[model samples]
Target: MSPTCELADLVLPSTHWTERDYLADEVCSEWVFGQQKAVEPLYERKSDVWFWRTFGHRLSPEWWPWESDEELFDWQLEQTHAGVTWDELKEKWIHHVPMMPSRDFEENGFGTPTGRAELYSVIELVSGSKPFPEATEPKESVYATPDVAKAYPLTGVTGRRYPIYYHSAFRGIPHLREIVPEPQVVFHTSLAEELGIERDEWVWIESPTGRITMRARPSDGIDPRVCVIPHGWWQACPALGLPGYPDGSSNANTLTSDRAYNDEFLTPGLRSTLCRIVKKKEGE
Candidate 1:
């Protein structure tokens, strides 16, 4: 559906934000403002408003009677009953929502069934779930099988973030790669020594689900029982890496199992899986 995926029949290139105008609210519910364009649209880039308006006209012309973004903004302002007007905001570049004083809890009462916070939730009980919140073991973690643990003893904690690269993004930049050049799996030095692995050496982190090769970094910060491998590395992408690290980087999820998941949420196990790290073998 996206550019790399190449699943779409039509791919209309749009303009970046620098070439277009935008109106948005602040992080808080306090202010709404507009940002002006700095330059003309480059290449085939188009403003976001243009697409929304175009799509709206196609879906239903009556619902989108406005001819331009300005007209739409005016109509939205007309619908608001506040004392302020769009003209004032156009000059000010911001519209602030007036703050209200805190309400009296006892006199006003809460918008709850008992007019107060309930220690016990009746909704959860009615749904036939746990009445109280309690920590439970990860169903797919440690306690699965005694035999399995004998082979894959260590615990894995994946998805650690790096400051230089974001989740699969910013990797293509040369400057960022120069900062943190390789994807590494951190382990306690003691564990590495016991496993016959050395620092900076290639190692294979293996689980019943899958295995991946990455560089080993010795660190006291890492728990001996737990191994840390970062997420979002792609050997297939244009991301640069060290000489030993190839064009195809091992993504943590490739070695993660999706077979078992929470019945209620239907989520895969990205963390808390049984695994072991060892020196990379000849074939691997």
Candidate 2:
């Protein structure tokens, strides 16, 4: 039997030879046994296996046969030998996978665990996590602590915009520089006035963890309780090997704490934290 079939037999012992299993087997085998010189073999194989396993059942009946595992393996080997990288192969596989079935929701009942639309989930009750269907403030809101509030008085939100030219990456592109051109730190107008900071003036946004400087854009649209910092700024200082961008300063990932992330879901709480901003002093 093929390596795919062998793996399938090992993992899914009870299931019959379905087309889903066959396709999954082939994809996994290729990822595992494909060329390693141009790319990592095991990494490629594991990723491919996951992709096929996740979406393989969505394939239509007409495309079910999968043309045999041997043929699939041979084709992958040929592609690998031709210098096609694993990333490229994975992309090809994703592009070629059959599209999901299109049908009105009324015809097909909801696919929830209870077989009905769930307003609240029993998942939390069973899993011993938060017992709610929607987001709620953590049992211990970090902002509630007096020390945390004093240290980081403003709410710091990250990932508030697109990757290209959002935070500090704008310095890398000339066109982006000509257009947006500068790092923008958004704050509530009331907060800016309270801090005695003017719009378009330099402000130092500091949290208990770290600090960075950006031009303030005080606006009424933002919540007064929160301060917004768009992600993807690369610190630009001549001394730091990046010149033209004196303030190429960011990658919110660096300042964010893994411990502050959600407990049950493990989602990063980048948007739900407090921070404080002040006017940057001259000569420093």
Candidate 3:
């Protein structure tokens, strides 16, 4: 269970990887991995396939004809790759597909309205945007919003990953929590000195949108004007005497804004957000 699950009114027990059979593939790789189940589902828990198939059957029996995960896997394999079977996958555990020859763009041209790897897109022009690519400053940054930048001078990058935990996961695990006890605002030594913050000391990282408190972790590798704060810090490790950090307390998204985004994809400006660090006083 996770922080999201903790807040859920109705929780359904799902099978762990050890209790489920599945297929996994590495990105951009020709290899496919068959994940064999090591153990059966304990208690009232069931595999996601079971849960979905059960609900799907009640909704529409015609579409959810597969009675077992193996049947579904067979159909998936047939659709994705020919000459591959479930039994062979279970026995081998891994299969390497032969890579296809690269398409000759020079001979056949690219896949577009105006092929040949168009630098100026006809589709974009038709959509009333620049035909060619144009790089611009983010709408909520030090460069674009100078007036707001005065209060928030540092560039705050959110969701810095830790080896021990995935985004907002495994924090409740004692061993992992011991490895990374608390979330820290990682910045340059110069910035730490300027703000009179020491290593492992609590500090407030305030942006124009919002603010969050985290332990200060100064490093020489990062830029003085930039700070990296990790996300997913809600779960508590009772063994470490660490309480769960409330949503607005340490979650990086609390300091981010959804008001402005990229012109092309509408990705919220998380990395380019402006912020400032201040050392936390006693009892605060």
Candidate 4:
């Protein structure tokens, strides 16, 4: 069980990807792939649409009339007005939108108040932002706060994602865990050498908020003044005999603070925070 699931009062068993029919979209890609259901959902497990439809029927049957996923998918395709059908998608399993190498703005004009491409936005100005974009330094970065940087010299980069898993998912899978056994603090080889940290050795990455321990992994590609840590890591793989790192242990979020955030969006300054790396003592 995951840390989140452990905290929850009740957990519902949902149908896995292989047990559902769905469409997948890749970022910035023109191709849409159709996935067919491999097997019926196991006991007590239901697809997302099933849950929604069940609730909808109880609440308002008139609003949610589609009986099954096939009906819902058919209605969705009909709204596209492209004459694409569920049977066609299921047969081919892929559809590609032909991209024309021409700007739509030339034919239909830009979608703005002035109907033109704008370097300075009037909408942003009305919404209490500067007309032109400004590049400001991160609130907790080494360059922004020199005094804080003196104590925490290295730049900390968090939320490094790997291809084996999406964010913190698939960690409980034995095969995936075999590839990435535990969390790691990735830094430059030169930085690790200077700190007297050995490869695969435990090290503490400390920031103003908190500190977390991760295995040292020195890489030549990383900047000497920067260290990267992964996030979303609260799952355990029992088959591999690996213990799950609890919250605030190897979790990179422990080192970040919500105090410093983007002025416009209020996004926390976790990416470029200042931190120091130190070698952990044996059995400490």
Candidate 5:
């Protein structure tokens, strides 16, 4: 579902959470509760339970316990607080269970070596994870060797766009797009003058892995050496129209690389990749 979907022969629309009999083991603040459905579904969509149970019965007839979702739901509710039942949830829509602070291990203190908070964790030491939060240089940095900087001069950083859009999602949402119309690449005012890049000019940000285009906005708040791009763009918007999406609206991932990463986890270096900014020519 990223870069391209050359292998997908057909696609199906999915039911939104609001459209079905919703359920979740939600943990918020100090209590846990089971969520219930809100409204009836409108489209040609079916509940996820139907799909899961159908697949389960097909995959393992011996171990699959239930003939219906109601049977499975009843089985799950039986594990809740002894006094509560699914009937209560159907009527009240939620049942809250207080976490057992009543446990008598001296007011349920943290089960640590000191019987209190331990700044240095013995648990991580045993698990072989990093015991302390340590700062390390990015895999790619502006302070890197002179030759490396010359080749890819600017640092690329990706950040959240807005509350409405989660990554590349909801750009097609008209009201959300009205709040923040388009993606923009911000730069320091001095850097903009140095590069002869005018305000609102479209610029291509090229990393070692790939390149994407974004509009330029000169601001003193941003660092000249770093190019901050918003996250989650795809080539499927109707604004592009063409099956061949040559423009950078889908250029979101092109500004990042996986060459360097966190030592403990192989997470991509989204904020550490090096890139060069270029003003786009006419019609590009």
Candidate 6:
């Protein structure tokens, strides 16, 4: 054990090592193996709590006693006899959780130095960015300026699917691929026709910043101005040598912007952008 520990210590570089070496070693274990064990438990626990809180009333009568015909004690005995453990039975049947009423106020009641919800936030004042009570404009209007809007006409939205094998990652799988086989650029039928792009054909989507190639999928469900591309596509497999797809293809991140995002929260707006699409040439 001591020898193995000594060997591991030797392999793990000191804090003074450069970022690239640190990242290379970190990725081998942290991304490849450690990620699942680290993340799955937090996700599972949150999901379980959400399930219990959201639907606990439906499964047991005691959860809604004012509406229930039976008493709480009767419900407990009934649940316990059915082979549920005491803790599980109590969580399902005996807890009396209160529900809060939803309210919307012009001012949410917290005051700053001005003693009111500042129409302009303190940060805006401090940073001299833009004043608060900012005008509400249609999302596409940001690009409506004559010069900027012409180059990037369509609203490009991304990242709206499950994490594992979303977008184009699982496109090579038989059963899953049958459902959705490739990175899809979703646009309205009229827009697709205007661009002379056909459904399921490979098209190059471009922003002023960057571009990536994906299959077009025209749809009426999305707003006419909005175009969607789901996220999470791994670089293509080199060993398999698949046609029309090369190594390092299909990551939506390639076409996304790196601008400072919206002010409500520090979260990056991966879902919103401006782009245009064109069909790929025959070869190369």
Q: lDDT tens digits, residues 1-284, model 3? A: 56577789999998898999987667455776789889888999898888898899889999999888888888877765635777788889988866676778878888999886788898888887788898888887777888988988888888588998988888888988888999988999998888788899999999877889999999999988799988888888888888888555887887888876887777887655788998888899
In order of listing, the candidates' clash counts read 6, 7, 0, 0, 1, 0
Better of 5 and 6 by lDDT: 5
Model 4: per-residue lDDT, tens digit, 69-91? 77877776665443567778888
Among these predictions, the greatest lDDT belongs to 3
Count of clashes in candidate 4: 0
Every candidate's lDDT: 0.72, 0.57, 0.84, 0.83, 0.67, 0.54
Give me the runs in candidate 5 sitting further than 4 Å from their true place.
Answer: 1-10, 28-39, 74-83, 101-133, 144-146, 235-249
Cα lDDT over the full model 1: 0.72
lDDT tens readout by residue for model 6, 13-32: 22221111111113322121
For each candidate, give its TM-score against the true structure: 0.73, 0.52, 0.89, 0.87, 0.74, 0.50
Q: How would you order the candidates by TM-score, starting with the best?
A: 3, 4, 5, 1, 2, 6
Q: Per-residue lDDT for 78-107 in model 1, tens only? A: 554334555566677777766556577669
Error (Å) of candidate 4 at residue 116 is 5.0
Model 5 worst lDDT run, 10 consecutive residues: 240-249
Error of 1 at 35 (Å): 4.7
Candidate whose TM-score is highest: 3
lDDT of 2 by residue, 1-284 (tens): 22235456344322222212122224533333232234333322433433453346356535433444444544554544434433554445422333345465577767766766676676776788755667666422443566777767666778677545544344555554444455678989998888788878877777666777778999999888777887655533333333343333544554566546666888766654566888878875
Candidate 1 scores a C-alpha RMSD against the true structure in Å of: 4.7
Error of 5 at 266 (Å): 2.7
**Residue 113 alpha-carbon offset, candidate 1, angstroms:** 9.4
> Could you tell me how far off, in angstroms, the CA of residue 174 lies in candidate 1 after the best superposition?
0.8
Query: Residue 167 error for model 1, in Å?
Result: 1.7
